[model samples]
Target chain A: MTERDFLCLTPFLIIAIAPVMIMVVVSVLRNYKVVYGFSVLSLLAAFGSIFFVLPSIPHTIEPLLILDVYSMFFLGIIIISALLVTFLSYDYIKQLEGVREEYFIIIFTSTLGASLLAVANHFVIFFLGIETLSISLYILIAFQRSKSNSIEAGIKYLILASVSSAFLLFGMALIYTAIGSMQFGDIVAALTGHDPLSLLVRSGFGMMMVGVGFKLALVPFHMWTPDVYQGAPAPVSAFIATVSKGAVMAILIRFFFIIKGFNNHYLFIVVSGISILSMFLGNILALRQKNIKRLLGYSSIANMGYLIIILLTGSNKGIQASIFYLIAYFFTTIGAFGVIALLSTNEYEAEKIEDFKGLFWKRPFIALVFTLSLLSLAGIPVTAGFIAKFYVILEGMKAGLIVLIISMIINSVIGLYYYLRIITMLFSTPSEIKLPKLSITGNITIAIVGISILVLGIYPGWLIDLIIRFVSL
Target chain B: MNVFFYIAAVVAIISTIMAISGRNAIHSLLYLILSLLAISVIFYLLSAPFIAALEVIIYAGAIMVLFIFVTMMLNIGLERETEKKWLKPCMWIVPSLLAAVLLVNLILALKNVKSIQPDEEAILPKQVGISLFSTYLLGVEIAAILLMAGVIGAYHLGSQKKKVKHRFLEIN
Candidate 1:
């Protein structure tokens, strides 16, 4: 590889090295604060390294990776989200006894995996990235092994994820057999020659969609979402909900756009059906959920349902809308889960709706931040979620996806009801329970997320312009 | 070559079936090993001797031995009587039938494709290694990372703690 190739790979290389460095530090020093500081510094350095490669916009490292503006954009989101999760995890994980430092090491590895997904240009890298991310998550979810719930979620995710990975590998094998290539560019070149997809390719793509759907928590493949979210620590749940799903979403967009999967009638119909089902079922199920984390899980399914509508739009505007939507979602989700993480102590998880009873009376600041997050999720005005949803709906209409647009709108309203219910509970008569003392790191993370949401909601022009300038299929 | 291929394929299929359906874990594992060997024979017959050797040495030899050890260490077969009572024909029949249906469909699909005869020349191990290290080097690195994560996670989760109380209470 040339120096330029190495330059394009700086972010991934940095992230990859961080975990090993942390492992070394752990073996020697075994200080939680030191490891945590090193992790944050490494992430910051990785984020900064993106600019060093900015002058070299589009660079493909053979069959494996492509470092481009689009991937960089996603890398930015993934790295920053991972950093925020690390911040939120500080107090949450510190409260756990023993082996706390390894948490940062796992976060570094998972972030590396997520970053790899953003730059992946081959099936091999795609599969490896996903496995790295999922395996780390399995450990992270079950990190609090004393809790049977955590262990249950980890095992559940492991089995389901492995099954989905099998389907994906089989699909990849089938597709390779059919097209005689695994590279995205080569597959599309081969596909353009065949006007219609063959049975084998169709089946392969169908099975591949199952794996993607499972990652995105789309309908029918969404059974694990609520359980896993509820079972995992709040910060880890935030990591899974945002960074993991966003990385997959980034790869899916790239893959679909390259393959032109949206143009095929059957593929389009199938995706539309999945999205619609996800929106309705996700919202409907969330309506009765007392567990706030599970409620957010279902809401996320609905949010993803909304997000995929842009995929069917089959336009550059659609891609921008999707990225914008993900940014909004990253902030909203982390903010919401950060609140849970803040309220939760080592002794108890503050996940149930009743746990937040009269939270506004007790701690008005946290309640307000939670309110902002929930409102944004519900697509209420003056929150990032509203503008994100509106952008998506507008793009969907531009592509004349009326059916999907209608479903999203209806689902948003249904989503509003549950969000409002929680908001109401937050404001109701005070419950007699002492809240955990807020840490400086957690509070700073929440403030950054809250401000970004408002900024994106109110003044999204700059980010949109940045996306338009750099991001291209 | 064709006859040998067919014989190995049939053995692989039969052993795979036995592996899944066998009541005892050790028996099932032994059947699985047999199936893997049959597959390796087919691979060798198809002229990919390197992959066939790797399959036997890595999968059948190393991984299967680990499985056996783990199963033996768990002493899972001590409850064979209880498992046999629970493993009614009804429990196995539906899945077996479904799998058979899938197998039939797969066979039909394969029948539609023209089969290409394997070349007489075998793929050398040196060339395989060259390509794997050169073209797929990034994949190999990623896989290493994946394995490291898996090992660390497994080690972390598998290690037993002295305090086996409520996870909540165990936390500070």
Candidate 2:
């Protein structure tokens, strides 16, 4: 390895160091507030590191990972989401006992793992990064050990994740048997000559897709999503829905982009089918959901479907669009979950739709932020989701996936009903019960995210140009 | 050499079955260790000696020891075993089907295996070590961190009583 390789991988090294350093610091100090402050500072430093290496494009960390525009962009998203979640977690985890410090450790470790996923170019790093993320997530989900639902969610995630890992490993074994190497570039090179329909390689790819699909919560493999989301602490849910999914999706895009020309029509069709199901089923089922977290869970599956439309396109524009959408979705989803986390107290999680009734009267600013986030998620005009959906549709049109584009439009319309329902509840008569006051940190997080959403919606040209430039470069 | 492979494979399958099906946690853990050892031998046969060694040391020796310790600590002794209606059948059926399919595929795939054309420079251990230390050094270090995290996690979870005692003393 050269000095250049080390330099390229510096961001990852920095992220890895932050959590361990914080962990060691916590051991000595053992102050919750100090630990939390350190966690936020470390995450902010890690976030800053992304931009430091952004200007230098297309650098490979040879044989294992790469630092490039795609990676930097995703790292930007991951770090931003992590920072937001960490800020939100400050108030959210304060209500809990004995585990607040450890929560920061897990959060940082998981963020480090997710960032690794964004840059991984080899299966081993990919697997390691994903497992790190998963193991941390399992613990995070069940961090409230006294809550049976939380423990159940952890067990469910573990079982499903272990099964998916097995499938992924078996797929890797088959792919290695077929192509003799696990590196992305080498696999692409081998695939260019071989028939895409070769049983070994096809099945391997199929199984690998299943594994990724489970992580991304694309339909058929998404059964654990709602239960896990509802059961997990709200901030952790936000992290999973945004940063974790974003990192995995970024890696999937990189992998698929290399093998773009491989005409795996069957896989394409399967992906398309899943996308259609996820869009329609997710939106329709979310309509009946009373639990807010589960509703977001369903909506997330639908959003995943929308993102997959770009993958189906197989163009540079498609990749650009997906990246842009991911940024938009990350902000909106994390911001929305931040609001939920803010409202939650020690005994109650504020999960039911009724719990949010008349929130606008009590907390207009938070209500407005939540409304804007919901509007964006619903693809209303002048929100980030609108621009994201428009870009995706345009990319789909470019790929001539008119059917998928139509399905996305239809699903977005259906999706608006539930998102708007939440908005309407905010305006209902104030409940007699006193509502929680928003923390300064929570308000700042929501405001920042809300402003970004509006800004991205109104002027997406710069972001689109950035995405295109990065994807092409 | 092929005969040895067959025997090793059989032992691995049997041990894996025993690991999952054994009622006693310790017995299952022991079988698990045996299966891991067999897998290491298979890895050795496949010329991945480093991985084989790591498998034995890290997985069979360390992780399994931790697992057994946890089992003991949890005090899941030989108690009244609830009848899992599907588990017994699943234990017999799933492994058999998986093994049969894998064995058949292996045989079929081996039929088309081209004769070995060894590269003169293909020194597996040296190459792997060099690549690991050079190109994949970050991954290796990360793995070490991961193992450290696991150890720390185990200790944190396992030493609850001690932590409580320490806190009590501090409070007093």
Candidate 3:
């Protein structure tokens, strides 16, 4: 590797070292505040290091990774989301009984995994990055062992994720057998010579989609979404919803564009079918949902379905719209889940709809933040989701994907119903139960997320300009 | 070499079946080890000595030992009656038949695919080590981090401790 490669790898290197440093500090000090402080600082340093290497990017670290503007942007997103999750995790982990310090370690490692996925160019890095991310998640999901639900979710995720990973590996093996190379560029080069995809390559791509679909929780593989989301701690659920999905989406976008997979009408139709079904099925399932986390989980499925329409557009504008939507969705999701995490008391989680009964009466500030988040998710006029959906629909129209755009529009309407249902529940007669006091970090994190949603919603031109300038294939 | 391959393949098939059908966890594990060893022998017959050795050392020796230790520590006594009830002929028969059909399909698919010519020279362990360190160094580092995450997760989850009350509330 050249000096330029290491220079461009600054963010990855810093994140990789941060966990070891945290481990050392934990062994010596055993202080929660110290550990949390270190984690936040490390993530901040990692985020800053992206800019430090910005001038050196558009460089590939041969055979494994590529460092470019696109990846750097995503690494920024992943690190920032990890930072938000860590901030939210503080109070939630403090409420747990024992071994809370180790939580930050897993978070750091998982963030590293997610960042790796953003720049991965080979099958090896793709598999390793995903494994690292999921393995860390298995522990994070089940961190609160006192709750059987947590353990059940962890086991379910572990088994299903492993099965999906096996399918992915088999698919990679099949592709490698056909092309004698596992690099995306090589596969594309080999494929351009053939008019139609070979049986092996086609089957391999299908199996690989199964794994990706499971991770993204697209239709047919989305059964685990609500269960896992509801079972996991709210902060972990937020992490899964944003960082995990976003990173995979980043890689998928890169791979698809590289392979020009959209040209194959069969694959295009398959993706279109999946997206439309996901939109309808996801929103339809959440219509009468009581659990807030599961409702958001279903909302996430529909959101991803909307996002996938951009893939069909096969234009830079589509990619920009997807990134903008992801940014909006990230803040909205983190803010919403952060509220849930804050409201959760010592023993019981505030997951059920009834838990938020008359929340507006008791804590108007918290309730307002939660309301803004829900409004953003529902794509109300002033929230970030509106502009995101508008941009995506505009791009879809330009690309002539009327079917997907229509489904997305209908799903948004269906989505607004459930989000409104929760908003109404928040405003209803106040329940007599007392809520937990919010922490400083949690409050700050939610405030940031909430403000970003409004700012992005209102003045989205700057971010759009930034995306057009920096984010390119 | 072909005769040896057939012998090892049969041994592997029988041991795999025995492993799955066995009620006692330890016995099942031992049968699995045997199956792995037979597969390694088949690998050796295919002239992949390095992979053969790795199969015996890693799968049969190291990993099987870990599995055995965990099983022994857990002390999962044989529930033969439940196993018998659950493993009814009808339950196993259908899936087994389906899997057999899949095997046939796989064989047919392989027959259509033109096989690449195998290298005449055997791949040495040194070559594997060199390539892993030099060309695949980043992958190695990533794998190390992955294993570190796994180890930390395992340690944190496995350690037994008393559930302390919420710290802020405890002092109050």
Best candidate (score: TM-score): 1
Report how far off residue A132 is in candidate 2 (Å). Answer: 1.8
Off by over 4 Å in 3: B1-31, B38-47, B72-119, B162-172
Candidate 1 residue runs with Cα over 4 Å from true position: B1-7, B76-121, B162-172
Best by lDDT: 1
CAPRI verdict (incorrect, acceptable, medium, high) for model 1: medium
Writing each residue's lDDT as its tens digit, candidate 2 over B93-135 gives: 6445544544553454345333221322223778888888887
When summed lDDT is taken over every stretch of 10 residues in candidate 2 chain B, the lowest stretch is B114-123
Query: How accurate locally is residue A438 in candidate 1, as Cα lDDT from 0 to 100?
Result: 91
| Model 2 Cα shift for residue A77 (angstroms) | 1.1
Q: CA shift at A295, candidate 3, in angstroms? A: 1.2
For each candidate, give its TM-score against the true structure.
0.92, 0.88, 0.90
**Total backbone collisions for each predicted model:** 0, 0, 0
Model 3 Cα lDDT, one tens digit per residue, A1-473? 87888888888888999889889988888999999998999899989988889877788887889888988889999999999999999998887988799899999899989999999999999999999999999999988887899999999999999999998888899999999998888888899968689999999999998988888999989989999999999999999999999999999899888887778887899899999999999999999999999999999998898998888889888888989999999999999999999999659899999999999999888899899999999999788989999999999999999889988888889888999999999999998888988778888888899889999989999999999998989
Backbone clash pairs for candidate 1 read none
Those runs of model 2 whose alpha carbons end farther than 4 Å from true positions after fitting are B1-7, B14-18, B21-34, B53-128, B148-172
TM-score of 3: 0.90
